[model samples]
Target: MQKTPKKDKEVINVIIQEYQKNDLPWYIGYSGGKDSSSMLKLVFNALKRIEYFHKPITVLYCDTGVENPIVTTYVYETFEKLKKECKQLNIPLLFTILKPKLEDRFFVKVIGRGYPTPTNIFRWCTDKLRINPVKELIDKDVKAVILLGVRSSESEQRDRTISKHKTDNEYYLKQSGSSSNIIFSPIINHALEDVWLTLRYNELPKSIDFNQIRMIYKDAESECPVYRESKGSSCGNSRFGCWTCTVVRKDKSMGNMIENGYSELKELFEFRNWIAEFRDNIKYRCSYRRNGAKGLGPITLEGRKIILDKLLKTEQLSGLNLIPQEEINRIYELWEIDEINVNYQEKRLTTTCIKHG
Candidate 1:
């Protein structure tokens, strides 16, 4: 099936020219998500069919420490399968993983430092998880060209976002800080239907399963963690962010996955729902947060109705186990940090009082 879009043929040609270049490192970024999957198929097919594309193409996937179980599995399987397949075809398949240092996961910050679950305005999650990981992948090659499967038609906001980066010549090519670091989005012009059409006609490897995750997006359920410019509800769902995301109360993607017979993962969803309900409970949330609500600026991002007592209750009720010893240990460390700071302030006050007296 010639899913090569008619309008985007020129973009493909340019991408092909870039690939044909002798010196540049072609690092195609894959998220194991649909958009990236389509990009993978296109680039893989293009490379496989043409001798010039046979040059080394690094298929980089950044594992954001916390991804959907299915997504994680898919990524690993896809990387391995692609590598073997490339070996058979004599093409070098390069896969890279970019995860944050130990201090960047949900537990380290949320359970450790008492930072609340990220809100829309302050999405501390994305820079650590999504953007940072992608940057790491790009940083691998000295003269790297990062191929992303970002399409203009994905969203109005996405279209506008990509437009700003457009140079007169390239559709989705942008310069990174280094002259060697270049990002390319070849499928920027392809339509959604075109992507699906390509998938429907071609048989993806048994290692890759798109059928399972399709339901998350099947019903117009989109809650993107990425900052959206629109006031209306976010137009992307089944995203692979925190499971404890309290931002979107009704997570259509999680709901879809659960309702679709992922019974094993049902408890996590239930736990998330309970956390959202109990978020406002003052009893569970500390009255005086570690920073005392004042230090964290005017807005008190200090409270979460997930106290130790409530967590015990939640564990009993859900029959779910939180990470043992870790959260408790983290809370204790933070409390100590807070206590030391409080004591220093007290000592300063006492000296000042004595000085005045």
Candidate 2:
């Protein structure tokens, strides 16, 4: 057996102490990325060293449905193996995949309700797609500790945010807008190399292919937060998000993944590139806001239809299920509602103009 490093041992001991501190269920926010993977590994080792399981430790993964297909497949497969092996090993770890509500799904907003693709200024996808689902689940518990894999070294913005949220314990943080639950980052102090070391050294739960993660990282370098708490935090900067993300001027990571021979990403990449440009085309957007105010607003009904058509075409070309059938149904329902509202607004304007004339 490989020996654990002194730092890792220290962190694992702290994990055990924290685990045994109270009856509060522990929820680990896992993204299947290096930092989260390391945190999970440390927690797993801590559990192995202990004798009795008093409280539930659930691992929560948010699947935005639009996550990069490569990472998504890896996570799904890893979870299957983890479920089986953890049961055999009696680790008592529960794994759950959280998803956005139908109305909040990416396509439902963009293609159904005519939401323009998210730009940095108009970014709305993170809250609806990623954070809300996790928040809703955590809210069910009276009080819980959320374990995230966020690191201070990722960026200066992240460092400042972490420092601002500091709790009495350096490893813990107070979650914004929530008084009930607190955040715990096990690998908060770990540098980037330290994170990789954790994955490299701690090899238990062989279900997680650390090597495969390394290979993926070679092609795609960064990760979006699984649970976002602060506005200053990092996301969608060459990290993974919806393949259709347009917030970043360019999605260098996905581009790199394609160049690195992830051929499956080719069609999706092209479609994303097209849509990023497409969202900016004024011809596809309504001149008035959804609220009837004069401003650039949601995509026009015709724009939504065109986007849906192209999305379907892309789906066929990529051989991937880009959007779920339920989302499609919801999109159509939203379209109906929007069409009625648009007609009503037009009629009101016409009536006012005739009276003035």
Which predicted model would earn the best TM-score? Answer: 2
Per-residue lDDT value at 191 in model 2: 89
lDDT of candidate 2 over 10-115, digit per residue (tens): 9999999999999998899888888888899999899999999998799999999899999899999999998998998989899999999988888888998778
Residue 211's lDDT in candidate 1: 66
User: Could you estimate the TM-score for every candidate?
Assistant: 0.74, 0.94
Name the runs in model 2 displaced over 4 angstroms.
Answer: 219-221, 231-234, 342-357
Clashing pairs in 1: 222-236, 222-237, 223-236
What is candidate 2's CA lDDT for residue 6? Answer: 74
Candidate 1 per-residue lDDT over residues 1-357, each given as its tens digit: 454455444554666676776667777666666666766766655555466444577776655544555556667876787777777875555667666644666545665555555555545666665555566655666666667776778776666656665666555445534455555777777687766554444443434445643543454322232211212323223344456666665766666777877654576677667656654554333334443342232111233224445555655665645445655676667545544552223232221101110
Predictions: Cα RMSD each: 6.4, 3.5
lDDT of model number 2:
0.82
The lowest-lDDT stretch of 10 consecutive residues in candidate 1 is 348-357
Q: How badly does each model clash, as a count of residue pairs?
A: 3, 0
